[model samples]
Target chain A: MRQFFGWLSLVVLMVFLVIGALFIMRPFGEPPSVMDDYIIDNAQEEAASNNVVAAVLFDYRGFDTLGEATVLFAAVTGALLVLRASHKKEET
Target chain B: MSKIVRTVANQLILFVVIFGLYVIIQGHVTPGGGFQGGAIIASGAVLLIVASGSQEIKTWLRERRLSVVESSGALLFILLAFAGIGTVFFFNFLVGSRLFGGIPSVGPNPGDVWTGGVIPLMNLGVGLKVMAGLSAVVLALALFSGGEELEE
Candidate 1:
């Protein structure tokens, strides 16, 4: 039945996720640090800010922030557009 | 909402605005930043909107004005990024100069307010953008649900 297959799939996915988290994934807070180490060591001196996270967001990885802003702009534009259309019909 | 709620919301918004600005301005030395601070401010706006109906709120805040603020914030953010394009995109060009350029001693020490180069400016821009954008969205939703429309 459909219900049986759905349950089977759910169990299968859960088993795989648990195995991946327990065995395959590295321990938490110990990511590959080739780039992180450099950022941590030199961010204050180079970026002239005590907050390394801010330096990373505004200076080091700023292009990502730009993209994020663009995404927000687009989303807001779309929502406004959709909401405006319905109201226009009522006004006319 | 009741009379007491409206009066309390009116009085509390001032402190909310102050705390949000503090979070945004000190972003370079603290845990909070533009987006978080902006969200906090927008929450304050939401509180006001809830206390006052959409029809009452529309007399002061219109979609057109909020859109203008959002656009200005976006423009400022991009302008600050483009200012440093001579050396590289998003370069810390003002690192050693006088304006927000004092490099802090590299270790555990007291935080300095004027040491983030362009980051604080960028934070301000982003904070403005997010605050206006979110407030506009919530206002629009509230208006639509109440059978009202934002002014052109």
Candidate 2:
């Protein structure tokens, strides 16, 4: 079941990525994005950060960054738990 | 593995650590951000583990401390994110205020260190979390393999 789900997820990711590439991948050099323009123009004034990328990650798109952080935290917790559980099983 | 390798690692570790810190601390004003900086720092830790055997490292680098630091970093990042709840989930409230805040002129120029408000703080939390989490993984694998070898 686990292996099946893992493969299924990979397939899903590939499917989405392929679909996204076909429809959403912007052209090289000249892309269609007003959001990028806004971030670059007003990031320093609004977020007061010199690095526009940093401002975008931490301020403009913070929820996404938070989710990424949460994912890493959960991964570490799961790894430690599994390692400890295996050690306990050995002891018992 | 040998004396020469160990000596080289010992000398290079300090420089790696300092560079990582610079990346993390100046993330808001520099090219490198939290994740990049954290990975760099973790590389240094991995180098140390490789230079010295995991058994010897276990004496100085406690698993409990790594767990604590990792948890704290995650907590700090979340806490900082939540603190801007008044306006939004991650609002930059300290733009004009005096708490690690300094508004810079709009557009390209040399950036200020005491600016970027919560960004620098978030970078710090993320850097710590990544450093601890990665180091913990390497340490755990090393320790577990060491145990297996002993059992054999």
Docking quality of model 1: it rates as medium
Model 1 clashing residue pairs (backbone): none
Q: What is the TM-score of chain B alone in each candidate?
A: 0.93, 0.92
* Number of the top-ranking candidate, with lDDT as the measure: 1
Q: Write the per-residue lDDT of candidate 1 for residues B19-113, one digit (tens) a residue.
A: 99999999999899999999999999899988877888899999778989998999999999999999999987888688775789988889988
Model 2 Cα lDDT, one tens digit per residue, B82-141: 888998888877777786756988767787888988889999998999889888877777
Q: How high is the lDDT of residue B50 in model 2? A: 84
What TM-score against the true chain A does chain A of each candidate get?
A: 0.65, 0.66
* Candidate 1: segments with Cα more than 4 A from true spot: A1-31, B147-152
- In candidate 2 chain A, where is summed lDDT lowest over 10 consecutive residues? A82-91
Report i-RMS for every model.
1.0, 1.3
Please give me the DockQ of candidate 2 compared with the native complex.
Answer: 0.56
Clashing pairs in 2: none
